[model samples]
Target: MTTNNVRGHRRRLPAIVATVIATALTLTACGGGSDAASDDDAATAGAADDGSFPVTIEHAFGETTLEEVPERVVTLGWSTHDIVAALGVVPVGVPETWGGDDEGYSEWFRDQVEDEIGGALPEILNYDDSGELDFEQVLALAPDVIIAPVWGVDEVSYDRLSEIAPTVAHLDPENSWSSTWQDLTVMVGEVLGRSDAAGELVAQTETLLDDATQAHPEFAGASFVYGLTLSDGATELGLYIPDDPRVRLLRELGFVDTPAMQTVLDSVEGGNWYGGVSLEELDTVEADLFLAWSAGPEELAYTLEHPTFSRWAPIASGHYLFFEDEALAMATNGPSPLSIEWALANGFVDKLADALAGGAVTVS
Candidate 1:
């Protein structure tokens, strides 16, 4: 019988019956080896004999009744792969290139996975351009589950992947890249029968963030701006309105976005999901701290020197923060719980701390 049928049977029991049955089956499966077991064995010990099973997770794709801890899993998105790898699970497949071959994996991520897995990389699927699902390659792995918790893959892709095995989609629409590493570890923990371990991981990260935030309370009254400039230098600005996860994180660090950015948030139809601003209109952004992404350092340097650029408030104030293009791109498109932490650890937190400490890091 298919895995879905096994889970369906377990889903029918009363709350107590379900929980007891699931727990017993999970223990039995845990005792057994990691290999796939017989249908009757799985049906009795996996789900049917016990309703509670080890742990079940309900996600956007469908409910996953993880009867036995999944040994061979596949991650469809780059961030999902990072999440699994961070949890010490070497997913069977991961995207070969996230943005470009040159900027594939975030530096810290590559190091973590390689160090743990001894450089034995998974099947690298190409997600460089279109960011859609590659069904054929994924099915061949015969994964117990697929993790695709990013925005690139739409609902149609989610449905197709569900046919092959359990697939987890984005946690929510607005918080697309805002998922905390702690929550991701918990999700992987449930799938791998390591919830306790996941909880511990969350606790550790919480301590780290708390420490970072506490170290720089001066950020409490600080204001900042963030956005990106395209190939030709036209800006696509996004104000992190109060509810945005990134903005929430900044608030935790005691920083607020500039008042002008708040106005843009108020004026936009969709509250500035993305604002297209021409090079000539650079004067509008008014903030104590200016942050923006560019194709590379060369382009960023040119924009700073442009005569008309002098009017941009942050540019005039000498309080701009510039992040590596590749890193920022990954943060924008390939964001995962782990990657966000990597951002914090590598520069985001430290840079802000430096600014608050009255260091010599000038915007120009």
Candidate 2:
């Protein structure tokens, strides 16, 4: 729909996560105590699914149990707040959305929290520069349960938070933030004793995605590469692995995961589900579409003008989806029951259709 041109740019997050082998190695040694678990069992047995008191959840670091339903829940990672709110409970504390509007709230999430809490927002939990959870702030909230199913909490971070409350760590060992929307909903539902509601929410979202893809059959079998960074000095392109929530949504919509990209992921992912490769090496870099985060008009334009960028088939055909809005960029970052609808209401579906029909827009 729109267009621009420039020379070179690299869109990357500040903290590039590497293998956390050492951090996870100390988990059992640093995990929490039974006193808090026992206390939770005694105090919260009133909140259960048909007398399903004392639900124990096992995650990457360790197992956490909830005795009664959590009254003062605090969500540490992305989009879990949306899940908690959808299940009819507002968290006592949530982190400000780093990729959202200036108010540190995603547009969709902001609207939901306001409506649910009668215009009251949850307390802000902060992430440090290196993306570490703000433990001190979480402690101050005095929450009953800390749900972070998609968080990248190391053993030290887990034990430290567990000292305060039962901490639910990541569901997958391969990556901390790679839990899918279903995984999150079901896990959080068990923790909150709302399993039926969570299952319904998951079904609704899956239907929404299925309907959209059915309507736009062109998206089927369209291979895509979700890239956020292209190394400034080298020809390396930072690609999100298949496990990332963002890529998971794209695949859900019927886009084929390029075998080339999958192979690259196996090599560099180490213990985490993210990796990068030199653009010069892969004939596999080409895909039916290229979805990316644009730093700005000028930066994206610069990348487009570069010879290296043109080497990819998608770029040559202008089959790329560029997202300039931070909220839109993060629309699927945590893909909860609420956020999936947000992406649908936004232009994600239409953009895919447009790109499939050879829509060329640099401005987004």
Scored by TM-score, the top model is 2
Local distance difference test, per candidate?
Answer: 0.54, 0.69
lDDT of 2 by residue, 216-282 (tens): 9998898888876343464677777887788999999999877688566766646665677666765
Taking the tens digit of each residue's C-alpha lDDT, what string does model 1 give over 1-364? 0000111111111122223234534654655524443432211222112232456676654565666566567765546666565555566677654443353555544554555334455666654366565688878877777776654356788788878887777665543444554466677667765454446546655665677778777677787765653344444444445544555566556778766665556545652344444455556655566555556667766766766664566666556555444554464334444555555544566665654443413222
Model 1 CA RMSD to the hidden true structure, in angstroms: 11.7
TM-score of 2: 0.83
Could you tell me every candidate's TM-score relative to the true structure? 0.71, 0.83
Worst 10 residues of 2 by lDDT: 12-21
- lDDT of model 2 at position 114: 60
